[model samples]
Target chain A: MNLSRRDALAALAATGVVAGGSVALADDGTDGNVDPADGVPENVIGDDTVAILAAVGSVVYPDATTGIDPFVETYVSGRLSDDPDHRRGVVDAAAELDATARDWFDAPVTELDRSTCDRLLRELGVDAVDPDPEGSLSGRVRFYIVNELLYAFYSSPTGGRLVGIENPVGYPGGTESYRRASMGEETEHGRE
Target chain B: MAGSDRTPAPPADVCIVGAGPAGAIVAARLAEAGHDVVVLDAGPRYEPENRERQLDAHLRPGMEGPWGTGGERDAYTSSGERHYPLNAARVKGIGGSTLHWQAMVMRLHERDFEMDSRHGVGADWPVDYADLRPYYAAAERELGVAGADDNPFAPPREKPFPLPAFPPSHSDSIFAEACEALGLPTHSVPNARNSEPTDDASACVGYGTCKPVCPSGAKYTAERHVARAETAGARVVDRAPVQRLVHDETAVDAAVYATPDGEQHRQEARAVVLACGGVENVRLLLLSASDAYPDGLANSSGLVGRYFMDHCFAGVGGRIDRPTRQNHVGFNTTECHALYDGTDPLAGVKLEFLNYAGPSPAIDALHADEWGDDLLDSLRDSYGTHLAVGGLVEQFPDADNRITLDRSTTDDHGNPVPDVEWSVGPETRRAIERANEVQRAILEELDADIDWIVGPDETGPAYHHMGTTRMGTDPGSSVVAPDCRAHDLDNLWIAGSSVFPTGGGMNPTLTIAALSCRLADRLDRWL
Candidate 1:
C-alpha cells in the first residue's frame, strides 16, 4: 500500500528512534529545501526574516492531514548552525525577498500577510530564481534551497523514511560476472 | 638494491583483480556464496573532501573546473600535443568505470546475445536471455533503478522494476511530450541514482554531476558491494595494481603487485577472475607472457583484441519556450528512451535527451552569449531552457579498431601501457547520421528557435568501450565461453564488456550488470 505521509510520520514519531536525524515535515512535491541534513543556516536569518521564511514556507507547503509530513522546523534551523555558504546566501535572498515585498506593499516580508506574501512571492519568484544568468546567484539559489530544506527534509526525524527509496541489499546491481575458468566442466559453449 | 623485508604473499582461494563494476560484481557474488575472496584495485579510496580531479583530452584548453585538474599529474600523452592527455576518465578507483558513468541502464535485446543466429555477423552467446533474466532482476534490486517495468521499447525482462519511474525534469517532460506528439513513445530512462534514500548514502542532490563521483550516496558505486563482501569476510586491497596474473598450466599461482615502495608482492590465488574491463583486461592478459601462451593465456583463439567496439555519440540541444518544473534535483528526467530496435530509420541510433546536467559555462560562453541582453536572458531563462538530445549509434565490432601495447610508452608505475587505435565503423557512422536527422526533426517539431545548435556531428569519447574479448560458442572464433570463462585457460575467467560479443544499441550498464549476475549464479554451481 502507498502509505499515507501522515501514518508514516506518526509511526516514526511513536518509535522516537529513526536514522539520519529526520525532522518530520511536509512534502508538496516542490524540489526546494529537500535535504534533511543539520546544516541549515541560522543567525544570518534575522528573527523577522526567519518568521517570514517559516510562514512563507509553511503556506507554500501547509501541514495538511494527508501531507507527506510537516515543515521540519528544528531540523531546517539546525542546518544553518554554522553553515557559512548557505548563511551568506539566505541573508541576501531574505533581504531581496523582504525588499521586494516592501516595494510591493509598504512592509517587511515577515510583517506582510500570507496572501500579500504569496502575491509578492509569485511576482518576485522569477527574479529570485535564476537571479543572475551570469552572476553567482545561479549558485546562490542552490545553496538557499538546499539549506532551507536541510532542516525541512534531510535532518527531520522522519527524514530517512522516504517514498519507495530503500537501503539496497547486497550489490544494488549484482556483482560482476566470474572471470577465471573454474575447475568445473565446460559444457557446450555454456558452463553455467 | 631490493629491500630485505619483501616476501611473496600466500595463495588466495579466489583472486578477483580490479575493483571496477565488473570485478566488484564477481567478487561480491562469490563472497556472498561464502567463498574466500581477495579483491584488488589500482586506485586508493577517494572521498568528496579529497576527490580526484578528472580531465579528458577532448575538453577545450584552459577549461577550469574539478575536471581540469584531473590530468595534471597522471597525464598520458598521445601523438598529438594538443591535449596534455591522461585517460583520467578511466580511474583506478574502487568503483572502477561506474565512478564516472552517467548511469544510463538498459538491457540488451535478444539479438545482442545471439547476434550470429539473426544478423549473421557476430558470434552467438552460449548463455541465452532465459539464463540471465533473474540476475537482471537482482542487479536492478541492487542498483535501485527508477524505471517502468513495462518499458515497451527495450528487450523484455522477467519482472517489474523495484520502483516506478522517477519524475522527469521540466524540459525532459516537454521533450518527451513533443516526441509523443511526433508518434514516438517515451519512458523513464534507467538510472542508478535513488529517487529516494534507499541506502545509508545521502540522496541524490541535483548537482548535475552524475558523470563523475556522486557527492551524495544517492548513486550506487562499487563501495557498497565491496563493503557487503568485506562484512562477509572478504579482503579488499585498494591501491594494489596486479601487474600480471602469475600463472602456469595448473592454476593462477599469484598476482605480482606494483606497490608504492617499488616492491613486488606475489599474492597467489587458486583461481583468478580478470575484471579489469575492456581495454585494460586485454592488455593485462597480453602482458602476462608464459610458456604455454606467449600471446596471452586464454588467447588460443587469437581473438583477444580482435573485435573492438564502442557506441558512436552525437549531441543536440536547443531552448524550450515554456519553463519546466523538471529542473529539480533527484533523478529529474530522461529523454528519448524508445529509439533503438534496428527498425526505425534511427533504429541503430539510440537517443538520450538532456537530463539534469545543464550547459557548461565555456560552451555557453561560446554559443549562448550572442548579444548581452539575449545572452543574459537566454542564460536566465535557460536555468532549464536548454534541452539536449544525444544519440548513441551502434558501433559494429571492427577487427582493426583495437588496443595494442605501445612498447615505448609507460605509466607512472613504469609498465608498458596500452595504446588504443580506434575509429568509427561505416555502419556506426551511418547510424549516427540517421540519429542526427531524427534529432533535427524533433527540434523542428518542438518549434524552439530552429537555428541554435549545440553539437550535431561532434563526438564524445566512448567511455563505455566494449567487445574486445568477445565470448562466443566456438573456441577458435571467440575468446571466452558463454559463462565468460576463457577458452584456452581451464581456470581463467573474463568479465566486463570485453565479453560483450555484440554491442547493442543501448547503454551497456544494465546488460553488463545482468551478465555479471548470471556469471555469479553459474559460479555457485561450477565453483
Candidate 2:
C-alpha cells in the first residue's frame, strides 16, 4: 500500500496486533527513540476521545499514519493539558461528535468503522464551513477536531516529511542546515 | 491612595525604573562602577527553562501570546484615530520587549540626526551620529551584535561588528535574484543574536521562532543585563509598578511604587532614570502631576506627551513556481536600506526580505478542503513555493498623535492607564505607499503570482514606539535635554526610545542601547 514500515507497525500495534516492540513515536527531531505511550499522564482526556481523534486523523492524513494511535493520544493529551478553556472546547467538540454518530448510525464515533467515521465527518458539513472555534456546530467540529488532527500530523516529524517540511516551526534544526537550499532546488547560491 | 503608611527602602545612588534594555544597561553599568543601583520592574522574571513551553504556546492555535501579555494589569485605552494594539508587542517582564523582539540592531543613519537641517522637518537630535559613534560601538559589543561591513549605506563605524554576520538564508537567494535584476541593494542585517557561543549564551540554533521566543539563548534579552546587574550587587525589585514621582520644582526626591501585596513603597535615590518605554515614560510623567507642575512633571513646556511617533509597515507576498524555501530561517538576513538615504520628501523606507513568509505547512494543511492525499499535495504545492518582502516606513511626529492619561480607565493599581492618540500622518502614508511599490516591483520581477498586498491603508505599526518625551537642546519645546535629563528636573533623566526626537525607519533597539550606554557614562562621571 506504499506505506512506510513505521506506519505499518504503528497501525498493527494500535489494534493490539503487535506487542512488546518499541514504536517509533512522532519525531520532534529532538528525541526520536522514546516510546509515545511510556510517559503520558493518566487520563489526560479520555480513551474514547483519543480513539475518535485517531479515526479523524486517518482521514486527514490517510497515507501518513506513523505511530497514529500513540501520536494522536500524545497530541490530544498534551493539547487538553494546556489552558482550561481550550480543554473544555475540545472536550465539548468530542462529545458533540459522539452524539452525532449515535444519532446517525446507532454507535459512538470510536465504535464506527474508518469509512463510516469519514462519512460521518463529511455529513456534518465540516468541509464546507470555515474552521472557527466559537462558530456553529460544523465550524467548532472542524476547528477543535479536524484542524487539531491536521496540526498533530503536520507538526510531527514523520508527517512533516510527507509534506516536504522536515522540521516544523517550533523544532530547532541547527543554523547550518538553513544555509543550504531545500531538496529539489536548482541553485545553491545563497552563501557569502 | 495616600502613601505615608508604606515601607520605604534605603536610598540608592541611582534608581532606574523599568528593567528593559535601557534600565538594565544603566543598572549594570552603575552597579559595576561602584554605585548602589536599584531597578524596579512592573512584571515577573520569566524563567529560561520555560522558553520551550512558551514556544509551544506560540505554535498552538488560539492560545494567549507567547510573551505573556493581557489581563487587567496590562490594560490601556487607544482613544486615537487608529486603534493601536498597545499590548500586541509589549512584554512587561524583566526582559521587556526584547524577550519577544526580532533582534535586529541596525543603527540610525547619519542623516537621521539632522532631520531639521537636511529635510527642514522634525526636530534635530541634540546629539548627532558622531557624538554617539563610540557608544554605538560599545552597545554593539555589549549586545554581541553579529554583522558585517557589507552595508555601504551605513554610517561611519570605528570598529567592525563584535561577531560575524549570519549568511543569507536560502530564501534570500530567491529575493536577491529578483532584487539584483531590479537594481536594489541587499545587505546583511545586524542582529543582536550571537553567531557563535559566548561566555554566557548559546549561538543561533535556528529554532524558527525568534519573534515570540528564542529557545536557545543566542538572541539578546535585557534579563541578561539584569542578571549582570544583580551579580554586581544591584537590587532588582520585580512586580513593583511605580505610581508617581515625589518631586519639587528642581528634582525628583523619590519614586512611589506599588507591590503585589497591595503595599506602596517610596524608593528614594540621588538620581532617577525613567527607562520605561516611550509610552509608559510619558504616561508616568503625566501621572505625576502636582500643584508645582499641574500639567505633569518635566512638563513645564506642556510637551511631555507630545510628538508621538511609530514606524508604519508595508508588506507584499506572492507565490513563485519554484521552491522559495520559506520559514526555514526565523529572522531576516538581507535588508535594503538603499532608499533610506534618498531625497524622498515623504519619509525614508527600509525594505526587509522576510524569510518567514507564506503560510506554514500545518496552517495550509488545516485550511485545505480535501483531506488525506490531497491535503498533503496542497501543502507541498504551497508551503515552499511562496516568498514575501516587507519593510518599515518612517513616520513624522505630530503633536496631536500623543499619549495622555485615560482618567476614565485605570490599571490594576488604580492608576490611570495610558490613553494613546496615535495617527498615521499623510507623509507616513505616502512613504508606506512607496515601500509597497518597491515591494510589489520585487515580487513582480520574480515572475510570481501576487497573492496579497498590504498597502498604507492595511499597514500597522512595527511596534517601535518613539518621539514622545522627545530630546532637544531648547527647554521650551522639548521634554528632555541633550543628555536625556528632564528639562524641568535636574535629577530626573529619561531613557529608551522616548528621547528619540525623530525616528529614522530603523529598528530602534540598537539606538536605544547606544543612548543607554551614553546615559550611563554621563551618570558615572556625575556620580
Candidate 3:
C-alpha cells in the first residue's frame, strides 16, 4: 500500500499516458495531452495531473482569491516531494479520478464542466480508488489533494489575514502589539 | 608552564566547555573579574541575522539544510531504550538548547531542595533554596524575567521581577476562570522574555514562534551572554569539540579538542568547567579516561552518568463550546499549581495552558480520512476552540536510567555517541495519571466538549535533562560537591542542570542559570 513515486509513474505508464512537462492549454481551451516519456521536474506534478488538480482545487477552495491550483502545485512540488508516500498517494488518486471521469462522461476530468466536476468529486467520496492498503485510498487522496490545498491556503499570509491574523508564524510581518481586548479585566489575584 | 616551541597555548585562568547559559554566565563573571577565561563550543555562533535565516529555513519544509555547512546543528545520536524522542528535542549551537526553549522561567520550589526531609523520596540538595536565593534574583535580573509580584505559588523572592507579567490572552482568561471555579491555584508563569525593550534586546511583540526560533531578539538566549563575555575579554571558540581532559595525577592540566577540519588542538587551563549539558558532560567525562582514573575523569564514585532524569510530562486537550481567538497571544502565559503540594502519593505537578493556532498535531489521526467540506468543517470547529493543558510532573532520580557510551554508533567526528537508557518508574506513572486526571477535571469543569485525552504515553519530549552528574555532600554517592566542584578533581567544576540532585516540577533553565551564578561566586572566592 505504501506506493513510491516510481511505482505511481509505472502505474501511469501502464495506462499508456505519457508523463510530460508543465501543464499547457490546448487550442480548443481543454487540457493539452503531453508525452509521458518527457521527464517531469522533481516535485512538480505531471501535465495531466496538474489539469486534474486545477479542476479539483476550484471545487475544494471555491472562495480562494488567487485560486488554489497554483498554491497546490507549489506545495506539492516543494513540501510533498519530501514525503514520497504522500506524493504517491496524490498521483494514484489523480489517476483514479481520471479513470472515473472517463468511465462516466467519456472525457478526462479536466475536460468536464465545473458543476459536473464538483458533483463527480462529491459522489466519489470514500468510494474513490485507494492506492495504499494501510491507509484509506480515499483518505490519502483527500490529504494529498484536498487537505494539503487547505493547509497551504490557511497558513499563507493572505489566508491568515482573512482569519484576522496579521502575521502567521512563518510570514514576514513585524511582531504584533500585546492587546488585552476581549480578555476580561484583571482581578486582584491576576485572574480574569 | 612548559616552555616548548610546540606548546599549545598559555593556560587560561578558567576554561569552560560549551557556550550555553551556564558556561556563558561563568565565563562572563570570571572574565569581568579580570580572570583569563576561554569558552569552547562545538557549533557555530549564529548571530541575529543568521538566526532569522535559520528560522525561515526551519519553518519551510524541504529547506532545513541551510543552517550550517555540515550536520553539526544536530550532531548527537540517541540509541538504546529511549522512550521519548530525545535527539529532535536537543539542539547544538552557540546558545545551546536555549535556542529552541520556550523561555518559561520558573524556580524550583523551596521544598524541592529538601525532598528527602519533607516527602521521604529522592535525595536532598546539599545546599538549600536560601543559599541560592541571591543567585536566583541575579539570574532573573540578567534574563529580564517578566512575572507578577503577587503570584502566590512562586518561591519567595527578595526583588520583584524586572518587568510586569504580560497581559493574559483570551485563552489564558478562560483557563484562569476555570481554575478559579475549580478552586485550583493559578498564576502568570514567569518568562525569560522582554515585555518592554531591555537595554540589550527588543521587546517581545508576541511573534508566537519561541520554540524553533525567535525572530525578534526578545527571548533571552546564551548567545547574548556569550557576546558579553567576549566583550569582557573571554576568548570564545566555536566549532571546536572537546575530546578529553589532559591531566596529571593530582590536577587537570589541559583540554584537547578537534576542529571542524579534523585538526586537533590542546588548550591548557588552571581550572576546567564542564558545562556541556547533562548527557554530553557525562559522555565527555567518560571519554576522558586516564591512567590514574581509568574509568573516567571525576568519576571515582562511579556515579558520573548515573541517575539521569527528565521531567515527566503529560498533555490533555479538548474542544471548548465557544470559538476563541486563542492564537493571537503568546504561547505559554498561564499555569496552575493546585496539585504542586506533596500531599498526593505522587509528587508536585505544574500545568501550563498552551495557545496555538489550527491543526493541532494531537488530533492528526482523526483528520486522516476526512476530505473536502468535512475536512474544512473539522478545521473550523476545532482550530481556535482547541485548548491544551500540559503537566510537568516531578521525576525521582533512578541510577538505572543513565547515559552510557554507545560504541556501535559514532558521530561525524568518530566519537562514540551517547546511549540513553531511561524508563519512567511507578511513582512517575502514578504522577502522570494524576496529572491527566487534573487536566481532564479542569476541562470538564469548564464545560469543554471533551474528544480525546492523552497521557504520558502520547506526550512529547520534555527537553529538561538533569541529574547526570548530581551534587551531594558525600563523594561516594555524587559526582560534584555542594559548590559544584568535581569530588575527585581539585580544580574541575561542573555547571548546568547536570549538578541538580532533583528536578522539580518546573523548567530548569532559571535554576541552571542560578546555579551557574553561585558557582561563579564560589570560584571567585576560591581563586
Q: What CAPRI grade goes to candidate 2?
A: acceptable
Q: Output the number of the TM-score-best candidate.
A: 2
What local lDDT does model 2 show for residue A158? Answer: 46
After superposition, the stretches of candidate 1 with alpha carbons farther than 4 Å from their true spots are A1-192, B1-9, B48-88, B324-332, B344-347, B357-384, B451-457
Q: State TM-scores per candidate.
A: 0.68, 0.86, 0.77
| Fraction of the true interface contacts (Cα pairs closer than 8 Å across chains) found in each model | 0.00, 0.58, 0.11
Per-residue lDDT tens digits for candidate 2, residues A3-87, read 3344333222212223224332223232322224433322246566677777777777766445567666655655554344555
**Candidate 1 chain B weakest ten by summed lDDT:** B52-61
lDDT of 2 at B491: 95
Candidate 3 positional error at B133, Å: 0.4
lDDT of 1 by residue, B1-527 (tens): 01223244356667888887777877888888988888777676555433312211111122243332233223333332122123744767677877667777777766667666766655567777777777788888877787775457766766777666665554565676678778777666777776666654655544334555455556777777777777777788766777888778645677787666777788777677888878778878888878878888678788787677777677666665654322223233454545566544333566776643354322232222132233334444444345567767676677776766666867666667776666665566666667767787787788765544333245554577688888877989888888888877766788788898778777887778777777777665677
Ranking by TM-score: 2, 3, 1
Full ranking by DockQ: 2, 3, 1
Clashes of each: 48, 0, 3
Preferred candidate (lDDT higher): 1 or 3: 3
Question: Model-by-model lDDT, in order?
Answer: 0.58, 0.80, 0.70
